[model samples]
Target chain A: MLAKSFNIHIDNQDLLDEAFTQASYVNEHKGQNLKFYERLEFLGDAVLQLIVSSYIFQRYPKMPQGRLTRLRAAMVNEKSFSTFARECTFDKYIRLGRGEEKAGARNRDSLLCDIFESFVGAVYLDQGQATVEKFVQQVIFPKLDEGMFAEFFDHKTELQELAQADGPVDIDYELIDEFGPDNDRSFKVNVSIGDKLFGVGIGHSKKAAEQRAAQQALTHFDTEGDNLV
Target chain B: MLAKSFNIHIDNQDLLDEAFTQASYVNEHKGQNLKFYERLEFLGDAVLQLIVSSYIFQRYPKMPQGRLTRLRAAMVNEKSFSTFARECTFDKYIRLGRGEEKAGARNRDSLLCDIFESFVGAVYLDQGQATVEKFVQQVIFPKLDEGMFAEFFDHKTELQELAQADGPVDIDYELIDEFGPDNDRSFKVNVSIGDKLFGVGIGHSKKAAEQRAAQQALTHFDTEGDNLV
Candidate 1:
């Protein structure tokens, strides 16, 4: 499928299969000598980071480190990767266990994101870094150039601007709750604008939760008849 | 310096200077057309991640994603990168403002780490990814192979083992205090072994503080007459 679409010929079909395989599938079929996508996801993540970083580095020679970091994060994050996977029709190619398939894992954002990374990893192994970079430039950079990723980087600032335009409104993001183990904690946050709760959000980290809250607030303003600016 | 050490010819010397120049130096010499290391650091960070990730991926084919992530973090972290910079004698090459130089910024871990990333970025631009990977393998992978980074990854686990060796003593890492602004907060942690405070540590994050506390506790055991096991 990748070859047909992207013209990236995989030298080893086994690597491609490994990239598509989910852990659940491997775990369920215990006797099968199947490799899952986790390892590939790990490598692909680094490959993606390097490609995006290089692209932006050369594209915007004067852009500062902090902004570049934020931009790279915006491009490579779960939401963006999942979107890319969907655009590539990865849902059609992903292999899942019966249980996972029943649970709609094929359409899951996290799973899709993982698959994208794993695919990149497979490509890296099969064709090398140049091929991987070319694939990224051809497939991903177009979306980036179209400003599809700008919202991911600017949600908080945009929310702030929208709030302040109404004249000195107190916008506060309060962490209402946190749960799970220390290594993997989810935080719930509420965004309040001038004593009124505008929106609520939940995320893996505090900053993520705050950003989501701001995004929610912006969405709330958009849904209403209120002009954002 | 890098060219002489690595035997790779640099196409642009100005880029090398830019990679060494701190933002403070650029700001101080406002009239001069100077570039800081931050941009290069951004690109180099990704380059470093890719190289390290690829190295470990090939070296430990069967390692799990969680462990791989932890190992990569240990290798690419500020402490590790700063150590690499020191090993390469980057302190002598880095350019800092007079005020920053007076404040001993040359030896600062954060600055050193940033400079190393910037250096890698410059090398990538000057020579390319293959050369950058070769440089990393030559300079950094030897230390990784020697298990110099084992302490960074295994501090908590080592501390746990040490504590549990003497009939399952309760080990607690308590967050005593957190301060500074939301973006850059510092956490102070105390590691208590069986109701006695063994060590105290401070870091930019809670997890880092806890790790440092464990490291300190381990060091205390090592230095004192008390046997860790």
Candidate 2:
């Protein structure tokens, strides 16, 4: 049953086995978990900390450690887990028992969070941090965006996805630099869809800068995007 | 002067003066700071990444990423920032110029950790991750033990400081026994004052469990000391 639950994506028997082991569910379901996500969660736990730590370190420049700690706690709590779980479509694929499903465990915040944690543990075991960080950075921190307010993140990602889509759309990002040592210079980024700039964003990463700029475009286009699927 | 050198913790006035801005000193001496620790580290773009994403999801028994992330990163990067800083005495009673020193700037870890990063930036801000982690864990992590290693980090502290005044004495720590689950085990420690049990110490804290055991005993005994200062 545990093995069957983990039968999504990768077909590597070893990965499936390790994923079961890390979750510590193999034997309870049948007899043995060749591997479990426990150790990987340990690894993932460390990975998650650094990702958020680095992000907070960058995002909230003068927010101070106290606020940073609280913000981190809020972002990585059950709420973030559930948010990421939906983004990853984890609830659809998790291996739960008749009992859990019958109990409506799918939407349970704790369960959702657990799956994400186990997911981290499994991924860390399967591919290591470099691989895992992508998943975290792409999925997790965006949860923070949602936390600041839910609608904002969806709007933001939509704009970013639209802008980053290389098919056949013209996107422009312009910056009016800030006053500072050019070495540590800051800038305000404005992103455009066609002519009039849609929105403005600021950040250190051209990616983050772009994301912020895209977010502004998103907000500006919110009315146009009201019925987006 | 004061405000500018929030990052500098020199005991020498000339050095403090050189590190300060006349405006910096005025701002700091007056007790305000837009500056903080790790500004330079952030400036250098020394971002730490999670090696993995939220894996515990979709993996096994279903733990969430939220709790998982916090536990995993307890020492992930900046845990390196913590425990070690305290141990090394990086900024314990730090000395600043009379201008900045009296503002209680010397006792700030945020300031301390910042200076620590600046010092790193000063030395090799552009160094490799391995070099950076090594310098921090070795140089800084051990420093996290300062309080842990405080008045009697070892028998040497007992001997050197106490022996000098009260003739001679032997100090020893015995584990006595270990208890609890391996991951969250508790340690029972006893410090011997010449074959007599000085006091007992216990902790559920991680890292240097054995040393912490000894450390707890030393601290408790020191507070209840039946001897002279």
- List model 1 lDDT by residue over A84-138, tens digit each: 9999998898889999999999999999999999999999998998899888987
lDDT of 2 by residue, A1-229 (tens): 3234333344355654443332324434765434444544445555566566666655655543433454567677787777777766777765555665677877788767766766675665566556566677667766555455343335455665556556666677877655457676566777777677787777765566776667567655412233221
Candidate 2, residues B38-128, lDDT tens digits: the string is 3344322232323112322222233333333432244334434443445545565243546566776655555554554444433332343
- What would the per-residue lDDT of candidate 1 be over residues B1-229, giving only the tens digit for each residue? 6668888778898999999999789889887888888889888999999899998888877766766787788889899899989999999988888999999999999999999999999999988989998898888899865878766346788678657766888899999999999899999999999899988889998889998888789875532211211
Which CAPRI category fits model 2?
Answer: incorrect
Docking class of 1: medium
Residue A227 displacement in candidate 2 (angstroms): 28
Q: Against the correct fold, how does model 1 do in TM-score? A: 0.69
TM of chain B, each = 0.67, 0.34
How well does candidate 2 score on lDDT at residue B189? 70
TM-score for every candidate vs. truth?
Answer: 0.69, 0.43
lDDT score of residue A55 within candidate 2: 67
